[model samples]
Target: MALSHSLIQLLISLRRQKFIGAGEPIRMLEFGEQNWFYDVVPAELLILIDEFQDVPAERRQALKAELQQILDTKPPTEPFDICKVFYKLVFNYEDYTAVDLHGTPQALSLDLNEPLGLPPHSWDVVTNIGTTEHVFNQYQAFKSLHELTKPGGVIMHSLPNQGCFDHGFFNYHPTFFYDLAEANRYEIVALVYADCSKHPHQLKQLGSQADYVRLAVSHQLSAYSGIFCVYRTPTDAQAFKVPRQGYYDNRLPPELQQAWQNLAR
Candidate 1:
């Protein structure tokens, strides 16, 4: 939910590489609205009760027609019905799940203070998509995501990094995931920063962790941005442990140690 068009495209490109595998069903749990994803992802294997009303009330027919038009015009080699995908599951806050075939809203909550009460290993994919910062208990919310994901499942997060006050309770850094990967033994597939202040058309390509120096200086300079990262849970189920802060992970090497220590010049 709350995905940028660029973010959707990123997922598509990554999926094409078989990063998460395509043929099998993808059980995705979104922490918020995923309206844009419906337009791009292959709907044949996607089942989620789309609770967000992306199109305006009066424009639904037009949007439907547009979807149909795209499907009809798509090249023969392309897979999936471009216009026919629908939302399948609805998440509710009251310790229950309710779904509307008509794609209407259901009771939902992302509160970290309360238990989600969902079964463990229930999802093949868990996406935070800018929700964790709003949850008062960041670690607890993340733990829920971890529990909800099946072994070998993927967890994705996109969070604010700079120049967005009043946006959420916390803004994250790339090192957070670097440290997280080491602590939890998660395999990191992608980690990058996107500048959000610009228009989608104007936004530059995302910078990977390899661009750490530029990212660090720009973020330090108050550039508007976010961090997007994907992590794969182990093939076997593991306990969800709160990750230690980066500098304290105990697996720290010299460069990382220097990064954290202020030099006594």
Candidate 2:
């Protein structure tokens, strides 16, 4: 998975809202060794970075230099490591780990089908960016995120919601997250749908978990979209909560089901 401009904005917004790095360094575990997809940083991102108030002046200057180097070198897109460079420079993380099936020879080979078996509840932020859809065993793919995150920490997922044919083993629906968060008792931080057919920043927020079905029927949204779900794990540690589909168990209202049925006709 690659880091797009929108993902950068989301991370920065989380920090601004004091969800992360309120007064401490971040410990982030990403599902993949993400890279910045663009050679030059987008202006929107630079503006946000300049406005960020948490970083000390010297650290900010260092960040400026790091970004300048990216522009100066115009590094090749492959193996640029821009995502790692930016996150490390900007957050100055306490720890950062990337688990992937492929990486440097020294990097551990990971299969998403099994638990990471890392120290339980060790990470402050865990991300599944564009990874789980490729895994056939979806349960294990998501359970690993639950196991790795510290209680009260955050878990973020960005996956294809609509119109990515044959790109992976499966695509996601917003209701999947609604049920997952409902079952796990995760605090809903943000739920957004992005029009990813073009630039990555075109996002539309889903007001609440209920809005997943509500908006789908009301707006008739059928685009090449990506679902971005950010949840704060419950403060009390617990086992992974298995979820049932919302409509099947009356978790979603009958009106929403009727509306969806009408839309299908």
Candidate 3:
């Protein structure tokens, strides 16, 4: 449940990209454990290895110190609260729900598989830093995210895509969001193959879903790549209706009309 430095980089970039407005308080639903930012994202990156990774102390510490020095040359613009970004903070976790935020990062719990039990269209931004891969009911989890998002809001997810094994229930393929975006008529801000290259972690810009599919076979990389997606819900939208796969949606096929008719009836 710890927030990763990569997640911090993305959000800061998102804000700079103007996807998120300056000083706009965002409501966050944490699917699991969440600590404040500074504690996790430290000025030094290696300090975070202990919270999640199993690396040698000397190796990580040394790597991060060098990495940290490089990062300090160009720190991200810090507008929103650290709770809204990175760093394992030093605040009392129990006070998370002391009251609803009027202009701050509000953390709440969300069960990806069940009804969010929250106000519909309530959150300005919903982030699944590292939880969706663990939830078995993927549809419900995504649906709950959509339901909780205010129209015109954005939902971002940092999901494992390749090179990582046995890390969770599933490693997402880009098609999931590509198809979902098409079905729900979403406006994609950015969807790309992201890598953890410090000093300059990069994200490949995705043009279209079809093009992405055609190129996937040719562009396999060695490191663990994450799928970073930003989807903007349309204003005046209602509940999300999951769309069927286009291959299956193609004319229902004359060969399957009888089955389709029976199901329709």
Candidate 4:
């Protein structure tokens, strides 16, 4: 799994809109040491560089030089570490850590299939971008993501939603997140369905499961569609709460059920 340009754009947009990482620096924890699909740095990242308004002018210039060095030194065939190179550089935030079983330069050796055994509520931001689906123990992986996030912090995920056939252990559906958030009392920050077939991705923001179904019917969406989500962990978030399937549990709100019914008409 790799970090794509659209993910970076999502992060930049969140900062600009003050969704998170605004007043002060943030401590970010990533599931894996992820690389970019792009051979070279995308030009649009200059906008992300500009948003580092909290940093001093000198430090900001230094960050730019560091980015330039990466471009000059790194071969295009070997993509740069998105977490270390892009996220850290753009935010100028040093409190970033990545955990991977392989222990790459940007990651600490840790297994996601078991308990993380790390300090709880230590990270202001926890990300599982295209990582957890590959973990056979989905429960443990998700629990780790939940446990790592600090109170009032956010946990971001990008998982297969519609049709990533044989891409990973499983493909997710919108109800999975909807019910997960409901069970954990996580505040749903944003939910988006993305068509990742090409660059400059197409996205549809979703508020409910019906929205996902509607988006599927409304367009010639690709089989590689993805669910992009950000959910805020409340200060009082308890232990990781497993949820029953929303459909069988009759958990969907009445309005949403009506919406789904309307779609069938």
Candidate 5:
């Protein structure tokens, strides 16, 4: 069995125990990590895994072989949707059929790399939570989102503030907010900080004044930058512009977007 499968099983078990809250769930499959959004919210969640380039050559080869074996052997379940092309896949596209009757139709899981290629107006909303900072090509990613969204489509994003510990290969970049909005021509709607101190348990784990100061400084310098953004596409008909800094502009609209731009500036 591949280590990724073991990890998924472990996560599923933990989820059943209520250990993992409602968050983005990803499964490492034969191709790449598949996002299981149908089990959660449909179109609202986009699955993005970090550190693809850093995998050691040998391990990557082993992973590909393991994935192929799993794919050839495992039968598709009723709820699963498999994509053999991209390294990432989607499971359970049809899970929402029953949900539409509940009056809470869930959104579908979208792959950032391989878009659905639907018209811009097809989707009502697009969100990127804690994802932009990891991209090596942030500008291109945001531009792609701009083109994908309809005019007035809402976008929400959560990016790390400067002082936080490095969770991925790339650390937080302060200019992400400005660049995203400017490039995509998105209007900023709302910007809110995800205060780390609110979670005292996490604070305790990161004990010590210096450590706390580092966290505070990083966030303060960059606006306590956790989960900042509530953006909306412009009403204007211009093509979506990619920002120079990060991938997408997280800003909302004129009234709200202006406020965040002013504050961040």
Candidate 6:
């Protein structure tokens, strides 16, 4: 069952406590200040940034110039924890080892296509914000995330909704809500929408008053509208399920059972 916003917040609070006591500081990669990082501290922290050619040509060039300037200047405080950041030019299977950046050793920059080989139940929290939609195989990604997290671990994710403009890259997909739940075998804890028009480009696209209204209404009705779901990993028995079988049996109160029979028929 999907979780209410209040229940989701409560779980986040509880997770924060356990995460604090885990003896290591919170470790976040590929996520930034927009996340819940301020709430927890880890003994060691690492961040990874992956670059891709899918970005707009102009923006890509501008970012490259910006990065070169930043690299030359060596700013006083690193934008993220730990020293190095990675730029993977191509997807390769054997590049999963740590890399040396700014004199620090951190895990090799991860490509969504590659596996980390992390044991099941290793992470306390995993967050993927606006990243999964870019992946070609979202189901495999979710399965990998499920395996990477410790039991009772949580995944915080945000997906784009309808009415979002195509940015020339494969930025959108349909039916992720149902797919993610089944893929990770997780119960959704919360679902919320994020107004992407808050970004200038999106807002500009809705130039006229009528256009803005249409966009707004479409966003409101979309099932994909930026969702935030928190799930507790099920126990082995609960997690295990056979293919082509109903997880819930038909035996129940007469009224409930009758409803189930009607649906089955």
lDDT of 6 by residue, 1-265 (tens): 1122322333334344542222333333322112122222211111111233343466445444554555566464333321222111111111222211221234344555455565556555565555555566654566666666666655656545555456222443222443445544765654444343442112122222233234444544332234444465654423432222222432234543343455322
lDDT of each: 0.58, 0.76, 0.58, 0.76, 0.40, 0.39
Q: For every model shown, what is its TM-score relative to the native structure?
A: 0.69, 0.87, 0.64, 0.87, 0.41, 0.45
Ranking of all candidate structures by their TM-score, best first: 2, 4, 1, 3, 6, 5
lDDT of 5: 0.40
lDDT string, candidate 5, 1-265, tens digits:
0112222333334334433222233221111122332323322112211123333456445545544554556544312322221122222111111101111223233444454354554333444544545555654556555665557665545456544566543444335555566666776655444444342212112222233334444554332334345567777646755455422344344543443344433
Residue by residue across 184-262, what tens digits does model 1's lDDT show?
7788888766777765512333344335544444443236787788898899998887677655655655654665574
Provide the RMSD of all predictions against the true structure, rounded to 1 decimal: 9.6, 2.7, 11.6, 3.0, 15.3, 14.4
Candidate 2 lDDT, 149-234, residue by residue in tens:
99998898999988888989988887788899989999888988887776645777888655666666677466787899889999
Q: 4 or 6, which is superior by TM-score? A: 4
Indicate the worst ten consecutive residues by lDDT in candidate 6.
86-95
Residue runs of model 2 more than 4 Å from their true location after superposition: 39-48, 70-80, 89-92, 104-107, 198-201
Cα error, residue 212 of model 1, in Å, equals 2.1
How well is each residue in 72-127 modelled by candidate 3, as lDDT tens digits? 66334232233422321211112122111122344444456676676778766666
Question: What is the alpha-carbon lDDT of model 6 when measured against the actual structure?
Answer: 0.39
Regarding lDDT, does 1 or 2 come out ahead?
2
Superposed Cα deviation of residue 236, candidate 2 (Å):
1.3
Give the range of the ten consecutive residues with the poorest summed lDDT in model 3. Answer: 90-99
Question: After superposition, which runs of candidate 6 have C-alpha atoms over 4 Å from their true positions?
Answer: 1-77, 81-107, 168-175, 182-185, 198-225, 237-265
